[model samples]
Target chain A: MKELIVLSGKGGTGKTTIVAALAALMPDKVMADCDVDAADLHLVLNPQIRESHRFLSGIKAKVDEDACNSCGKCLKACHFKAIRIKRTARIDELACEGCGVCIHICPTKAISAKENDCGAWHISDTSYGRIVHAQLDIGEENSGKLVSLVKMQVRKQAEAQKARYILIDGPPGIGCPVIASLSGTTLALMVTEPTMSGLHDLKRIAGLTAHFKIPFCVCINKYDLNPEISGQIETWCREQHANLLGKIPFDPLVVESLVAGKSISEYDSPASDAISAIWQKLQLAFKE
Target chain B: MQIAIASGKGGTGKTTVAISLALVADKPVRLMDCDVEEPNCHLFLRPDHMESQTMYVTVPEIDLAKCDFCGKCRDICAFKAISVFGKNIMTFPELCHSCMGCFLVCPNEAIKEGKREIGVISQGSINEIETLSGTLRVGEAMSPPLIKKLRDMTSDAMLTIIDAPPGTSCPVIAATKGADFTILVTESTPFGLNDLKLAAKLMEKLGQKFGIVINKAGIGDGSVEKWCAETGYPLLLSIPFDRKLAEAYSNGIPIIKAAPELIPAFKRLLEEVTQ
Candidate 1:
């Protein structure tokens, strides 16, 4: 099968709205939400979780108080200053990366390594198909790892069901998590807005997808917000030889759908019709 | 004092609040745009650059001639950025977390360090406000390293404002980590409220004290204000929804310059923020 990832370099750019609509349109596809840091797909899809798995990024330094002497050597070894010399030298969970250096360098061997529960991944059953999603802890790191895990789960489920496609709702910006989402995807659908920063970020993300040699198509969300900037974006895309997928106009129904915890397809059929055209073009472009 | 204006959601006026606050501050200020991936603070601040530095990260380069592809180098990598099965050793530099495990574990000394340009660190003055900003190289994967570099360049002064990236991700954490105080700028919409809650959770977990500035306050009802009151987080200032200001911002002009009355509002904002 094929994998199609929907990403917008900037947040709140209707990336999830389009993903939701696409999911509804492509009923047989397995889905994954790779935006673990602030995952909100569950707000719309409301998948019934079937399985859950714990994710561990690294070894967190834990202070064994009984081992005695609080010499604070672990604090010195920690580059992040995660160790706090409190009453018994507590480890700040948010600051810890599970480096294990602090534990190794502790004079009294009081610091220990333990499996830190960074987040949880779920194999859920949605109306469209099976979904692999995750919820990261509020202050935890390792979203990149979690995204990878979610994708793996989706692939495993897809293989079991002989699914034809995998659609991913990706996070904004080209960071570690975004890189994880982009890797191994057959085609990337970059949803951009009609603004200067929107065009700028689309280029950044487009460059990233090209670096990986992943074929991509661009869809400008809110194309009517500024027809002038949208035209410029279309021109720039043409100059770069990138496919300019159909543009979706500025629609308030997208917001209404989000607030109602529903997909655009379910919330507004007219908006879904526009998204369907974009989806149809993507399907034809990536057809084997 | 270093003040980082951050919000978990984009287009919530983090950059606008930062630029406006810096503009109205009487004392000298330094504004650092830690949101390297999509930095728009310069669009409003109109920073005149005086220096620029290319930021680089060292990735491992395997020596083919030295040749023994022992799996030790790949085993220690927590990110799984490297893999060696038999004689085939493949390295994914983009996935590498730069832990130097591969270099230290290479018994044949086959691994060598190579520089990769990830982003650029730009230093300048925005209308006499000593500014240092980072612009991530297009297609670069990581952002925290560049953010750390920018933070390291901040001068110790009365007020050093950082325009943090949206979301409670690694880059946002890196930007607001050790700040004296954080100001979260957000709107009153449902999405804004949802993401602000995430930002609040991040600040609370980081143990950094912070207040909130409600932008486009009357667009929605007082839900944002009510949440702030319920959570005991201080509501510092409010900027009403004005089309003229949005137009000015979209055209790369400071709101205070476009509307002089905004200066007093921003001044009052800083006073409340510092208080």
Candidate 2:
């Protein structure tokens, strides 16, 4: 099985739009939305959840007031400032990093660790094929762990269905969750736009995928927006020896499809033809 | 007063609104691009950086000479970054949360703090507005610590506009916390509204007062404005969808400079934001 991840260093650069378009062209693939922090692929693909598993990866700190000896040791030991000195020691759950310093430093052992429901992972069936996605609870951390879970589910579902491709729609930013999505992927297609911020973000994410020795291709969305920068990006891609995939033009249908809960490839628009042409090239890349 | 401009979705013009607000402000303003993972405000603002500092997180370093075969440090570590096996111990610096628990509990004092360069903080100025942006090193896992370090370099400007990173996560929370008010910039689209709910819920959870700014207002349905009215959340400003505005932004021109008429609107946003 091969894993193809769609990543854009900048968010809303049409990563999901590209993924959905690719899904339309490749129907037998298993889809995984690894942008757990701000998952929006479901809005486009319309996945009906089949199974969901509660994610319990880390711990949250809890204080037992009865066992507390107001020595303030736990308060002083916490690096996250999760502890506050109320009449009883109050553990600010939101601020806790699940580091267990408070649990270890309490003289009376007033603090303990408890499993936190970080989020939930779903194995859903989309119009394209099987999809594995997740939703992170508000104000909760550990998105990297949740992403790993979603990827694992994709692999399992792919094996059960005997699918050859596992396509991942990744999150923005080169942070923990993005790193988790990069692991074990066969190829990465970075979607970017023709703007300075787009170029700036592309440089960072490109550097990252190269650091992991992952071969990547660049596809500029809305290349018509700034052809000057688009030309500059093309030059940069050539210098980096990265594959320059076909550019998709700026089309209003991309947004219309998103509003209609559909992919650009499904709509009768100019973007559909461009994206379809890009899909043919990706198919050759997948075979290689 | 510190006003933060954030968006749940990226490229919804958080930096667009932020720079425009800073440029039209009558008083001296500070524009802080706290989106260290992808600091793009500098691209638009063209700030002259006066100082640059490498920000570091102090991770635990094990001195095996003073170490016994005890697992106390490993047992106390909440992040599971340390492990003790027989007479050997291992530390994974990336996984460490830098909570200092192992240092406090190490009986043999084997654990020492060591620094790792995570990102860089640069101090610059865009005309009268002082600007600071934190750029995270490529492949770094965490961003909240670097954001904390960036906010520590705050100027005493009467108006501080922080352009927070997209998403309602730790890095974003770290940026939007303690602000006088936050302005959420979003487009009027399905994806925008979906993510806006998460950002709104986050601000409510943080107990920080915030309003909404709808960019590209004419492109999609009016559900965003309708939602704001239903929820009684203040709709601070709306920038009409204009290809010219987007093209100007792509060329790195501030909106106020590109569309001079919007100066009055941003100035009004500044007044309403501070009120």
Candidate 3:
């Protein structure tokens, strides 16, 4: 089985839109949204969740007030400033880094460490295939770990269901979650725009894919917004020896399709034709 | 006052709104770009770099002499940055969260705190605004530390506008935390509204007094407006989706520069934020 990840370093650049469109084209693939922090593919795919699992990672320290021995050792030991010397020692839940330093050094053993429920992962069936997606609780840390969990589920679903391809919608920015989404992926399909920010973001993420030694192919979304930058991107793609997939022009119908809860390919517009062509090119590139 | 510009979705014009706000401000402002993974505010501001410094985060180093194969450090670490292979132990510094749990929990006192270079923070200034941005090393796993370091460099200015990273996660928290107020930027689309709710939820959790700036207005439906009306969340500013604005943004020009009429709107945005 092969995994294809759709990544756009800058958000709002049509990564999920492309992923949704591709899911419509390739009905035999398992879909996974690794952008756990701000997952949106499920909104488009309308998956019926078969299973939901709580992602427990990172430990938050809890202090017991009833122990009644406020020696203030935990306050001094905490470097995160999570423990404050109020009327009594209190732990700031937001400030806590989930480090158990205070738990270890507490003279009264008043502090205890507990695993935090960071987020939830879901196994769902969509029109495309078995899908895995996740939602990280607001303000939760360690989304990379949660992303890894979602991918693990996707792999399991693909193996069990015998799906040939795993199309993953990755998160924005070249950070931990993006790395987790890209690791061991068969191909990196990077979607970018025609703006200078788009080019800059593309290069930044391309640098990351290069570091991982993952071969990548670039696609320009809203290529008509600025053809000059689109040309520059093509030149950059050629200079880097990366594959340049076809570009999709800007169209309001694409947004309309998303608002209507349908993929671009399902909606009749110029973009749908462009997307169909993109899929053909993508498939052709994958063969090599 | 510190005003952080944040978005749950990327490319929702967080930097554009931030730059426009700083551009139209009557007085000089400090704009700190806290999106270390992709700090593009400098492109619009064209700031002159004064100095740059490397940022570091703490990671634990194992000392084999005083160590036993008991796996205490590995068990205590929440990030799983350390692992034991029989008598030998390996440390993955990139996966480390710098929680100091391994060093503190080492019964053999075999672990020592070491620093790893994660990224660089730069200090610079445009005409009237000082710009500070952090750039995480391309392959670095952790960005909260670098974002924290960038935000730490904020001096006491009348108005310090922080361009926070996208998404409602640890990095966004690191960037938007401690700000006097946060301006959550979102476009008027399904994806935008979905992510806006998440960002707003984060601000509410952080106890941050925040308002929303509807960017790319008229590009999509009016569901965002209806939601804001229902929730009573203040809609501070709205930048219409204009071909000129989009083109100028693509060319790295501020909206206020591309169209001078937008200055008053941005000024009003500041008034509403500071009011």
DockQ of each: 0.43, 0.82, 0.74
lDDT of 2 by residue, A120-196 (tens): 88988888888999989888888898998888888988998899899999999999999999998999999999989
lDDT (10s digit) by residue, model 1, range B1-275 = 78889987776788888888888887678888998988767666667766888988877888889859878777766667788888888888876656565776677989988777888887788556877789898778788878988888877755888999888877899899989889998888666787789999999888998999998777754668989889888998888877677556555677788889878778887887666
- Please give, for residues A112-137, the per-residue lDDT of candidate 1 as tens digits: 88887788899998887788998787
Every candidate's lDDT = 0.81, 0.88, 0.88
Residue-by-residue lDDT tens digits, candidate 2, B119-195: 99988885888888899999899999999887776666467889999998788888988899999999888989999
Put the candidates in DockQ order, highest first. 2, 3, 1
Report how large a share of the reference interface contacts model 3 reproduces.
0.74
DockQ of 2: 0.82
Using TM-score as the measure, name the better of candidate 1 and candidate 3.
Answer: 3
- After superposing candidate 1 on the true structure, give the runs of residues whose Cα lies further than 4 Å from its correct spot: A68-73, A84-90, A267-273, B57-116, B218-223
